[model samples]
Target: MREVKGFNMTQTINVVDAMCGAGKTSWAIQHINENIGQNRKLAFGDSGEPMKYIYVTPFLNEVERIRQATDIDFFEPEVKGTKIKSFKALITLGKSVATTHELFKKLDLDILDAIEEKGYTLIMDEVASVLEQYDISKSDIKLLIDNGTIEIGENDKVIWLDDDYKGKFSDMKILAESDNLILQNGIAMFWTMNTRAFEAFDEVYVLTYMFDGQTQCKYYEANDIKFKKYSVEKSGDHYELIDYDPTIEPRKETYEKLNIYVDDESNKKKSPLNSNYDSREKLTNQQRSSQLSSTWFRKTATPRDLKQLNNNLRNYFRQVQPTENEYIFWTTISDFAPTLKNPKCKWNKSNDRTSDNFVALNARATNSYGNCTSMAYVYNRFINPMERNFFREYGIEVDQDKLAVSDLIQFLFRGCIRNDEPMNCYIPAERMRSLLKDWSEFKI
Candidate 1:
């Protein structure tokens, strides 16, 4: 975890790269540890708020470097301050939110299906290699693969769940998704598969081993980031990269790890569970002329018919239903009319003032009457302020109150309006601004 000078430029995202046996894992562990330690208090080591840091790498074995370095349990740390999470855990969190919110449904389905389809063979191969290396029996390997529950697939590979891969067709889909597999290959094949998997990752670290028994490390942001070698010795507290000997064996496993794999091997395009595909269906045809006639058209109004209907509605309002009260309300609320009184001279409680209906009617008559004016007032005075806050929160550059309420409602609920659900924090701008100002210490 040697801190590189001037490396703390916090971009919203970054990539770190080094070759295998380089100090990428070491750097990650140290960065996380320092961040946690800086934020911690004495004794129980409370960091106040959980710092979100996600370390994504290919293979669960890569997880070991950081896990061992940080002295934390696999996926569960007893000594807690900062949360150290794998990319899979982060994806799961996002997936859970997506399910509840429907925000990431398509992405989740695509990724999940891909992993479920291919994750099995990879797991089986890895487990077989681990078992053979550790002198475990085939039955013992099977038991461990079935029961102990180790995640063995590469990153970005769809994760396999026990239920999704059961029965005959499952193994077929798995074979389709993965290459043909043979069990005799050892760690080398698994390593190659892992390398391919790791390449899919958003970031990677590359390292080089030298003839003098020293290793060099360089950071690559991603696969796109140029890979470079280093001759420097220091990495962090664990193993010295310059002194590292890959032949010395970093670690070895004895008992086979329990892992999960898909069960079936056939590809079956299953349809919706409750739908009856063989059921008879019928369509009825009626006369086109009759359908276009007055009675038929009235019964089944098309867009043209709907437009006529709306025009008829507006005409009805013009003739009969347009209420004068809306005009009065709009004018009064908008303060758009000339009848507004000077507060000092026209105090209602004064003797010179008159309680006059004539004055009120005259005031109402001073402006036009209709629902449109009242609706405009409702939108401009009431809705627009709330909408401005909405626009600010959403990072939208344009005013969106021109959008229909149903559209806005969908946006709010779908998280397009804000990353957090709009229902939880929607506020009128004036009120929110006042509260924010009054708080004095609030920022953003």
Candidate 2:
């Protein structure tokens, strides 16, 4: 945190760290309008030209939202030629533009050349995928190093020593040349967004919820970039910036409204546990961890266990709590969506996805499912152990539990509950249920 929330121009990296329904996007639009009016005369690197902005969001639909709400003329990456070419032309013209995060990641030295003098501000609608593991086998990496094709530098930085290397690793060579590829433990490869992109901008505003629990936050700290924190609050008909508070939880009414289908003796009777398995067998916390996880859904689960899960899903939507005409949503890993999907009821599935009502477990930063009345988040979320080890190699200890809770929170907000509407949620995994409960009570 750099400064208290206000209309300040000094901070280069600003995080509007607000909750899901706190109207963060509205505040950003207002801030843009104010900057357009004032032209940020006292802002850093200002040369009396009008302030230029590049609003980047996670989805193309959000790009349209910014274009529709803002008063300024917004240029998108055109389809005439390469999108990068159109974006480069926009940078040369010093115009405020809107695009997706994918294009923002592709910003190279070429774009930096055009943008260095433009003094453009960046408004990111959500945290972009700042760090991701690059899938390559350890032996393949060994071949690259053993053959004098590449060299591992300090801190496992993969350096392309072979200038004439235009073979199978050409794509890796390009990324390595641009300083985006990172090696972990001399085996795993990772792709991180270049921090130089932020240096090219006059200032940056990242509008998102739970920024601390995200990987991008850790990425910034590792690079020694300092950022200020603010929160969006509605005063009357308008929104304003307030000091960030991490403890902001949903209202008590909201807690009462959301029903995380509890598993009890009575509920188990509705979807009976098959007698094939011994009822007296007690599961340890370790054994129970597999329940509703990818391991259980894909491999270890017995037919009776899956039947009970499917039956439980049907019991909630059809037997226990029924709704009319409204959309329903549920999430699991993409691979297990079909395995757990309820094909009996139409409303149990949301439209235009997987030809059924299946949402992804990692879904976030969108308002496309506001009308969905019910959602079943079936997977027991966990961070990849290899990815966690990658961060640890850089002296950054990842919070696996917080990240899991954060993922569930982001996915839950995608439903009608975000607008303070009552909704039904079912989590078959006991760990996920406890995590959700802890979050609702501000326990974690």
Candidate 3:
């Protein structure tokens, strides 16, 4: 590890290039371990906590291979009894532990697309072959090609040719193609065995086969060092030596700080204390108890939670108070009650506007739930729809009796106050205007 300050800028892609036996995968793994492990010291509390490597490969086989090589299992069940780190386990870790967050879900198609786009290290194997295969699939290939060159971007091009060809013409094609792309500042690739391709490569290698003797391998640069030797041995009667050079080094220092942990499968037993949330009804009960014990429910509360609770309450007030139908319901119930001491309510109405009694009742109903004139109107129209939608979207169940105006206000205005952390919830006076508009709509 050099005394480097660190690569202050984030790397979008780190390419570890090497042909066959250059140990690219091993080098890449070493790099990842070093960088991630180093990063552990720097990763402290923040909005988004640091996670161990979220290894993403193309297929399950590669995923499993990486997991085994790293001594990490990525496919264990998340139940308490499970010892392995499964996809389910990773998510559970995010939910329960403070240090962890989330693992990307492959099921999330959006994330899959993002992985292909803005990913850090693609960790591609046989990358040139992959690219070649991709180019051959016309359906997957670029929808457009410009002249003899396929324009990769507004200014870049990709050039390809047959591997077996060996003539001055092909050599000229390689030079022209390389120079043309280089002129446009583009990337290019050429097949092996064509030493004419050496014109385009930064480094070169020489491979030799031997009988009853050692094989010779040398790496060299065109203008700098000529060659350095490496050995090759054979298992069968026929032997071939494949050499590639400039010996692509892994992005070691960067990934050394990155420590990805792969644990053996866990097989723990589930316990009563950590039972899963069974149903929406159970979750509601849990939430109610949690809120009831929290300081927000107290008369003298901390400014933050109290403010949030009040804001939640205000939201409920804005969403659920009475309209004309409700006022009519209230009056009808009050009038139609069986007893005078405790008058129950009736809400039956036919939308008749002739008599002004119902109109007066509707008008006066604005002050039913709070001091503000429009509180009642805001409560009925706005809060109801929002609550229903939120529950439907998140699969949460609400208990109306246990719910308070402040709690509801906090819930409704949470998104507004999210970025405004360390601040108390403060309702604006102008909200009453919207409430009034809601009230006017309910006039019968």
Candidate 4:
């Protein structure tokens, strides 16, 4: 592992571009472990102490999984060593913690003070998810102005009242607001996420997965030039040459495509670069109606319906002890169901949710029975005979009865099903197993 340096009081934010399931948390853990191995102590205020690291994820389940992956007993309060914690609990205790972005936004002054006083490194996982959640509305700007945190001059130039104001300012208050906080307080942040996280920062590290399934990390500094350009504009039939700062406008660029074999093949088939899918098109009547129906179902799903669905699943599982392949299928269902159920899930940006929740659910169920090749193995072995025997014992006719397992799972989980293709149900079985294991203790 290469040593990640230059992150200190001066340089605060560093973004890492890595694919999902690319061992980002593992890399963070290894870095911390290396520090411990080297016996390096960090200073906090007047006291010379060991510096701590905080890993922040986007979800609670991610926190648990990351904690487990560390193979460290983190729950013991007395242990001054590293531990995983939610972003909400970072200020209170736990020297080294793992938390979500949702919890981090609610940080109080006391917590911020503690963080500043006691030196710590923040490793933000799934940064794109966090960034998507950060939206500065007009109301927020008004409140900030009222509170004197920010002030607009008579000339309309924005001024930050905070003591830690950096030279970088923007007409767009949201960018300025984010920059002001991150650049101040000597808080070093390490961000890791997929390509969707496109915010320009101090430094960026790109992690690429090779054709052989190995990951390589490369560091690059953004040297994109910013210069002012004058343009002519007509206002009320009067032509005027207007001087505009294009820096305030968002930079438009295509993401660098990685040359992973699978990605290359997929791109060849349906490249977004070659496609002309206009996302800004007005919604059709059918789409509008479908969206309304979905919204209605999501809002009006009763507790009784949810309870019934859960009962059905429990009963089904009780009747059939799944084979290894079937268990893998069940694992995917368990992992996906919760995410679909979660209203807070960033499904749109992440593109994790499929258009047809029902078809996706059925695809998973059918895949559990295994593909043709695996089905041949099941029949050749004693598993198929045993399953048939069990069905007979339960007085269930295999051909006579149709199981709407997918429909039940989808409706129970997401509260609605759409008439569309299940294109996004291709999760690897190993990843599904890990997710299922993490969600073992999770209720609902």
Best by TM-score: 2
Q: What's each prediction's TM-score?
A: 0.21, 0.87, 0.21, 0.33
Per-residue lDDT value at 210 in model 4: 16
- What is candidate 4's local distance difference test score? 0.31
Minimum summed lDDT over a 10-residue window in model 2 is located at: 1-10
Best by lDDT: 2
Off by over 4 Å in 3: 1-12, 35-48, 51-62, 71-109, 112-122, 128-444
- Per-residue lDDT over 317-352 for candidate 4, one digit per residue giving the tens place of the 0 to 100 score: 243222122221222232334433322111233444
Q: List the residue pairs that clash in candidate 4.
A: 85-98
lDDT of each: 0.26, 0.74, 0.27, 0.31
**lDDT tens digits by residue: candidate 1, 116-179:** 3222111000011100012334564344346632223432222234544555436423432442
Tell me the deviation in Å of residue 386 in model 4: 61
Residues 1-444, candidate 2: write the lDDT tens digits.
111122233345889987788888888899887767456344355466888799999788889989999888888989788898899998888788899988888887668757766777889988888878887899999999899988877556678998988787888997788767878777789877777677667688998877777888877777667788997778787888778865654545566888767645655552232221212257666767656666666667777676666676677777666754247778777765555666533323344563555666666677888888887776787767776776666677777667777788788889898989888877666677677677667776
Per-residue lDDT value at 171 in model 1: 44
Clashes per candidate (backbone, < 3 Å): 20, 2, 52, 1
TM-score of structure candidate 3: 0.21
Model 2 TM-score is 0.87
